[model samples]
Target chain A: MLDAKGLMVFYENMLALNNVNILCKENQIVGVFGANSAGKSTLMYTLSGIMEDIKKKEEMAGGERITVSGKIQYKGIDITKLRPSERARRGLILCPERRRIFKESSVLENLRIGGYLASPAQANKTLDYVFKLFPALVKLKKRVGGFLSGGEQQMLAIGRALMAQPKLLLLDEPLLGLSPLMQAILIRATKVIRDEQQISILVTEQYARPVLPIVDHAFILENGAAVMEGSRDELLNNPDVRGAYFGV
Target chain B: MEILIYGTINSIALALMALGFALVYGISRIPNFAHGAIYVVAGFITWTFLKVVGLGYFLSALIAILVTGILGALIYRFMLIRVRGMAISEIIASYAIGLAILEGLRWGGFKGMTYTLPVFIAGSVTLGGVPVDIHRLLLIGIGVAVIALLWLFTHYTRIGLALRGMAQDERAALMLGIDSDRMALLATAFGSMLAGLAAIVLLPLGNIVVEAGYNVLILAIAVCIVGGLGSWMGAVLAAFLIGFAQILTVVYLGSHYQMVVALLAIIFTLIMRPSGLFGRQKELEERV
Candidate 1:
């Protein structure tokens, strides 16, 4: 389980995330819904400790001044100050937005790269599990990552994350630019991964209709704040939530 | 037949010289300007170990390579780590380190044409009715083996896979628990070892002079620039192109014009295609 309290991120004079609190219980699929520029990705980055890397790079380049204030606890350990790789070592893996797969590498290479943290046997087992979860990847083993279709790339991205043997997986915009059918397949696979692997998932999305039915608990983010948090049925009953996110 | 054989040898030699520079740049985006210094220093170290310390050639070469690798890692840890992400600072710091080492060696009395490594083997062989030294043939064999080994290592080994991941996407690699700093350190060390490998093999062909340090740096940069800064395959291809051109210039225009070929290749590549032949970053961007 992961607990984050009073998360605030500032980019220069602009507020990217403001006083947001989120939690993920063990083996649960938690969804964070938000529209464009709603701090969805920022929250994910902050929680996964990638914001620290961005902050360092920006500081080095004399670019934008990014200030992040948050206390994140993963399995009873304070991890807000930990580096991204350290956080990943503790099983907090983020499958970033835009499917940042190694483009020049082959599909198998991407998956192997993702297995950097795994033991040899664990990597082998996960390799099997990944290929089993996304059968399309098996045939595209030799194909370069960039050449894959959007859906395939997304699958490879998720598969790559799985290779890290994560306890909690962060899915950022996994359905972006994906077709309805592909979305359904991915969503189904997400659920199957949770049930089989018993890994907690914190998935973020702009549109909530497709993802709503699968999430155990969901938080609706608006303008960098968590405006609503409820169980699946509780959120579905809320008229405002239905109107804004479900397009009702 | 002479041209063909010598051209292949020259090409592989150029590839050997540039591989280290290309690798360090490719993985960490740190233009290791100390590459030539490492090469020259390794040659000197090998000479010291062999001549002064009275060690065997093989042991001296191995020890020299290990020392060079540590030196490179220390340079990264002490100097390059601070200036990382700033391109100009990175270049200045590394080139400064290179200058200090090369000049320091020159000042330290590590000079003269007498300092030379013996050839790995003695005598020449008749290949296509042309006499080629056994050492040159051995260099070609080692070069090919090194490339093949590197290919296998990157594809099959865990650390190698992690390095390849970091080369493509640093942040993404971080997300998967591949430490960027650790990978960079590994890259620098491995690159230094490669430079040492090149030195031990090629320095035997000529004297280990301080001037060769500056010349090696220029030649390495030219090959890397013409090949594509971070592309290993591009480096090999560009090496062949530039290497053969250099050989042709040496045969026709005189030996003095050889260096001009590499310089010309760099300038031509810059004017025609700034990204070089195998610069996948820009091409990948256009694709996506």
Candidate 2:
């Protein structure tokens, strides 16, 4: 239940995303595939309202200005310019890349913050559900996040986001720097969340093969534009996509 | 006998002072250099309202704590939270506020002068064969009582737990729906209030000069470090250690290098533990 129309984003002077649009159905998983410098993260940042675009001529022309013009709607609520915390409270949670975990904090403490948007009762329920999906998190509750291994950290990061009880979860490269087994484990958790809670997700990935099988729809982005968009089967059969993206 | 009593009293009061500084540092994650200034002004306020304005000591302490709280909120809302920039800017703002208070109070007649206590609690009592000033014994008792209360507040209160949580992870705290700005304000005020209590107790012991703030400030820093930066018990324990050290050193080695020795203790702790006695090992990455 999310819609993006005519989304444009630029980082300072560099154009990172242009004229992008996508729709996410309820309970569906949408995968966006792109290479490095393909403006994937830029689009996500603009949609998430973390970056702001300056409108002055000096900034827009040549200065380091992230100029963004977009209309991002979640469940018909216009959140194109809402603050990050407000957006989170409205259930648009980000499981950011590079694992933005509070390393010095304990695992349970990290999860407790995820419930920022939920009611006290809802927070308790969300914590229980997250613990179930990532059972390893429960045993290591007292341990600091910095001390946890890579796989455990990733799981904790994802679990922390889930505590927010988001309506449309945004995942930025969940597979980055993780082993195949860890990747599979996280990928499985994504499916479980969608199945059990009916929450939609928009996930961006650098590699397609590992993520696309579970995705209901796929968008192949090239250079700052959406070059391809189709259902899972259509994307799988497209010769151009297979050659350019899959290298098959 | 006097030396022993002096050392015990000074140890407790000094610990209380350091606890205030450590509390702000631990929760706000900023040194809040203005904290000493806050303590200084709290002393002035206590004297002003208690003596000049003819209010009783108890009432003056109450108003001083409230004013300190408001001062903290002003720093947080107008300066710390709203004026967004690096932490250096925030610290500069706090220092500026402290300077402004110092200037304002001086302009209003303080003039780099010292304060006098109208009431005095003079007399002596012997503790286990040691003769001690009654007021100082009261100071030690007050210190212990305040420490117990603060320990309970931090351990049992919901907001206190949230503050501890915020200190560890601000974003996570925000995610948990914790009101961070409010928490910061409360912690800042509560911390300064402890310094005010210490100041209140220290009255009648001597005159409180405008420049007298840093002497206690230095010891508080030492206590925080030896106690482990934000560790409550650590600050308390370190306070006692530093207090006893100051007493023992002054008696044996003379009083000249007491400040120097305290500074050395801070340096040694930094080189050795870096995290303070109870402070957690900080993460390598700068917070996002």
User: Which candidate comes out best when scored by TM-score?
Assistant: 1
Candidate 1 per-residue lDDT, tens place, B158-207, comes to 99999999999999999999999889998999999999999999999999
- What is the lDDT of every predicted structure here? 0.94, 0.76
Worst 10 residues of 1 chain B by lDDT: B279-288
Clashing pairs in 1: none
Fnat of each candidate: 0.89, 0.19
Candidate 2: deviation at residue A73, Å?
2.0
What DockQ do you compute for every candidate structure? 0.89, 0.20
Give the C-alpha miss distance for residue A196 in model 2, angstroms: 1.9
Model 2 DockQ reads 0.20
